[model samples]
Target: MILANNLTKTYGNQIAVDQLNLDIPQGQFFGLIGPNGSGKTTSIHMLSTLLQATSGSITINGLDVTAHPQQVRRDIGLVFQESALDRMLSIEENLYFCAGLHGINKSAIKTRINSLLDLFELQSKKRASVGSLSGGMRRAVDIIRGVLHSPKVLFLDEPTVGLDLPSRRRIWRFIRNLIDDHKLTVVLTTHYLEEAAPCDNVAFIKLGKLVSEGSPEELIEQLGKTIVEVSGSNAEDYIKTLKLSAEDYMLDGRTLLIRVHKPQPNQVEQIQATLRDSADIISVRKSNLNDVFIWLSSKGQGTS
Candidate 1:
């Protein structure tokens, strides 16, 4: 239940976000992806009413973010890139503090704390200092604290950036479960491609512009043909011979991605015949959202 129309933000000469238009439905898991300086964070800040937009407009749950900041805050929960938990406080104390901040009464605070602790699996660690918890545990606590008020919309920025694989998976499962159980609306920002796979819809941004927005499958379908990745010697020669676009070049480890318009009639066989003894076909697979991202960001700018 979030909408943005031609959202733009600038700091002096640098335009952090430009003409971004987003429409996210209720109970949908939306993803915002881009490179380091692609303005994803700026967009989130504007949406959260933490930073004022330079132009354009935003509304959440039918209230204008700028004109009705307090109303928007009442309906949305935000989990930042950095952990905002109080390291000195115990897990229960931290959530209790957040609940109080949201004007939750003392009588309901205890119930909310217990429920959140159980949902986030922090019940046993309730009395433990936040500093004593691992990064993943801290992340879970951070998210729980943000949602202590049981907000309608959730904004998560890089939720699992630095955690180990298990921790990352834990958060993923937790998020998925929360969405299903609570019917929550989520707007998650991340650069990790694998992380984007589970999202209901994805928005790709680059150079302060939104390049594409759709389901991952819808975007991948736009990039025709199966992708054949070959590795080892003579990749450059094969690329040149095929006249592959410079933008198509992907230095993914040792493999080179070759995108053909029509991958039929034994396309892999012809590649095997062409490369012959020069190179080896490391992997052959259909196109994916990653491929679509590379192609779109490299070719030119796009719109929703």
Candidate 2:
């Protein structure tokens, strides 16, 4: 569990995070999303006790992060964006070393390592050097090392930022399974729209302020639109023709977004038939998380 009230962080004149309040319940997968340099990492650092909040309170499992930093560290496992693995060490060796650092007994360390190797499907690569592992394998090992002590909260900063599609999906599965099996509360910061869209809750950060927070569905329902965007050469003129009913339309540059008043029989056919007069319609697609982000960013005062 994590609770932060008006958490603020300042680096001289630049405010990295400001009055960010968040509550992540036990076993919940929470996502912190924002564009580049939007204070996501700064917020995570404060919540994980890596950085001190300038003017707010953070409590993890009933203990204040600033007052009991050591205890907070014990309760949280942090996996940063950059790989922190010892490339020279073997997969098992790295986990073993991390366990030992956490004061786990040698007997228990071996058992824990074995368990993680099995769970992460790294048993066959136990003896393989970290540098020799694939990107996904190395990332998996990094995560295992972070959770070696079975911390209650997991802080993952851009967990799947640079991985290929397969590797990213694999990590997503691993993260979801870990939370479900261990009942771990996760605080994740990522820019990937797909990644954040699946989280139990999402908090949007912009220029250090907490701009928006809600479940993906709640956000979509609140700010997103059922966008029917038709691409064609006459997008502008077609939009003007639809302008008499302008209250139901939105234009983002070249995209013509029309809100459906209600479902009509053969709606797709009618919409296309209307567009056939002026333009050769190319595509029509539904709205997604990116649309929600766009709407929130447009209304929020904070910078991306």
Candidate 3:
């Protein structure tokens, strides 16, 4: 449902996004993730028709984003970090106002609002003022408002930021349900890597360039199957002396993360026993996308 080829964005001599190439199919949940100032937002904005690209072309649902922006906008939904609803307005009122702005049929507005409110399990609270709802509910309402028009593509940029783990999980359940029911294609960007662990595909942005893109499973597998986390007060000293046959490793402050190439039985146990005296905390678990992210960032210019 989305296509971006060599999409470039710049400010004078500073390139914000460099030759980004993506092909996100319909109904796919795709993630654009990276450290701060890595152009994830810029890439999404260009895809959503909010910002124009400096070079190359983009198409959303086969509509040229630059040439047919108005039509493209009709097929896209965007929910950013900030709440789009008025704090004082009732949830029902807020959704109605947004639906009207989207030019949704007046005949279908109330039905749509009711259906979405029910789906998010906020029907009883629909009459309550938005300000009175919890943060999670408010974010849910934001997602509802974005989909009020039933846009084919949704752009979520840090939509769950600042929410606690439970709240984030709740919001994700809502999003996944929406995708399942409506086949809504999602383009999400968030600092919470675990939240994106279930994405159909993910693209990693680094230094405003595409460093890696693949399914989360593929990324984790490519990095390694086993990850060793070593922490101690004398972490620097431990890092200097540590020796292990591994694909790669990264040091984060006092935490040393090691990715073992192909873990063998009892490998973690032996490693832990070997480091028992030197480290304060040593543990091992299956590698995940977070490991891949840290590995990628370490190989690039330090993330901002």
Candidate 4:
């Protein structure tokens, strides 16, 4: 379990994370999402004890983070957005060095490494240099390094950023197996909203403040049942022609997203007819996590 109370970090006049509070239960997958400058990384660093907070308090497993940083580090694993494995070393060597840092015995480290490598189907590449592996393979090795010591909480900061669809799915399957088998608490931050859809709980932040927190379904439910995506020129003009309220739609430069709480028959037909000549594309779809993200991001300074 983890708890953060009024957590805040400031750089003189600029506040990176302001009054952030989180209560993440054990064995839960929690997501912290926002736009480019939304301070997600700052919050993660403070929670992980890598960066100190200006004010407020954080505790993990009933121990104060600031007061027991050494013990806290022992109980947590962090895989950064960047690769942490040394390019020159073999996968086995990288994991060996990391396990040794945690005071793991040589025999135990070898056994543990073997089991994890086998689980990920990387047993054959144990002796291969990290630099020789593909991006996805290297990322798998990084993940192995993070959990090699069997930490309680794992922080995955964009763990599947640039991987292809297949690679991303493979990585997630491995992550799910680990969480299910070990009951590991996972804290994730990623640009991909679809990935956050599987999380147990998710929180959206903007301008260093918490905007909303709930299950993916709960957040998406706030928007209506169906969403009409209208891709056309001068989208603002279409909204006026449609005679919709301000809250019923979101207008981007050339795309207009209209939220329909109650689906009336022929609504899409009517819109198509109205914009048959002006619109380039028109489609009706269900509300999703991306819509929730847009709804939140539109409130503040950024959009991811």
Ranking by lDDT: 4, 3, 1, 2
Question: For model 2, what is the C-alpha lDDT against the true structure?
Answer: 0.80
Tens-place lDDT per residue, model 4, 28-108, is 999999988888989999989999999999998788999999899999999898998999999999998998889897797
Better of 1 and 2 by TM-score: 1
Comparing 2 with 3 on TM-score, the higher-scoring candidate is: 3
Query: For residues 22-89, could you state the per-residue lDDT of candidate 1 as single tens digits?
Result: 99998899999887889988999999999999999999999999999988998999999998899999
Error of 4 at 124 (Å): 2.5
Q: Pick the candidate with the highest TM-score.
A: 1
**Per-residue lDDT over 201-242 for candidate 2, one digit per residue giving the tens place of the 0 to 100 score:** 998888988787889887766553365677677677876665
lDDT minimum window of 10 residues, candidate 1: 295-304
TM-score of 1: 0.91
Please give the distance, in angstroms, between residue 28's alpha carbon in candidate 2 and its true position after superposition. Answer: 1.3
Tens digit of lDDT per residue, candidate 3, span 182-253? 899999998889878989999999878998888998877778778889988876676556554323667788
Compare candidates 1 and 3 on TM-score and give the better one: 1
Lowest summed-lDDT stretch of 10 residues in model 4?
295-304
lDDT (Cα atoms) of all candidates against the true structure: 0.83, 0.80, 0.85, 0.88
Give candidate 2 misplaced runs (Cα > 4 Å): 234-241, 244-254, 257-276, 282-284, 298-304
What ranges in model 4 sit over 4 Å off? 262-281, 301-304
Tell me which of candidates 3 and 4 scores higher on TM-score.
Answer: 4
